[model samples]
Target: MAKAVSDSAQMIARMAPVLDSQDYCFCHVADDHKFHAASVLATFREEEGLTLVLPLAQAQAAGLAGPAFRRITLQVHSALEGVGLTAAVAGALAEGGIACNVVAAFYHDHIFVPSAQARDALSILQRLSAAARR
Candidate 1:
């Protein structure tokens, strides 16, 4: 397993932005439409149905509404038990009037924001990183 970073400053400094071209969405997988593709980004089972984050094209092909989200991946590896990293990131984005939905994987932190605001979100994050390094 990759080492999880706990230092907030280090995490911020290393938050290289990675943008996915395909728009993503969270939708309930229909009974006839199970997401078995390896490319499916993530999934969670819920009482209503299977919630999934998959490519916008795939979701459209599956007849789901477009989620129209841009994914920004933080390159830093953050520990699941790490403190304040999420709070800091979220706070920065919030202060910029950007809504962020974050998913913490074992190796990295993924943030989903509105596609229209993606570029501005990146700028906000970059500034946050720069400020942290000061």
Candidate 2:
């Protein structure tokens, strides 16, 4: 089993950033819309609808529309019980005036930022990690 890392500084210092190529969007699919394995990155049941993180092309094919965003995976193996990593990472992005939507999974944290700001976001995260190492 992979050890969960909860230390804020270590999480930051060890964070290896990976930017995904495909554009994505949050979409709401009616209960009747059949879900295909390829269309979804993540899903959540909501009172209003089924919320999903889906690839832009797939979402568009399903009749959903939205601005395109890029996915950035923080390659640090963040334990689900980790503390402060989200806040610290979010703070850095906030300081850079970049908006981020974060999802914390069992092994890693994913950040979705607008496509226009994706590179900048990655740079900011890299700098944050470098600073933490000092």
Q: Assess the local accuracy of residue 8 in candidate 1 as a C-alpha lDDT between 0 and 100.
A: 72
Residue 119, candidate 1: C-alpha displacement in angstroms: 0.5
lDDT per residue for candidate 1 within 1-134, as digits (tens), equals 56878877788776776776668987787546656668589877777777788888777887876658989998888877877778988999999999999999988899999989999988888888888778
lDDT of 2 by residue, 64-128 (tens): 86988999998889877878889988999999999999998888999999999999999999999
Backbone clash count for every predicted candidate, in the order shown: 0, 0
CA RMSD of all predictions = 1.9, 1.3
Clashing pairs in 1: none
> Please, what is the whole-model Cα lDDT of each candidate in the order they appear?
0.82, 0.88
Off by over 4 Å in 1: 30-33
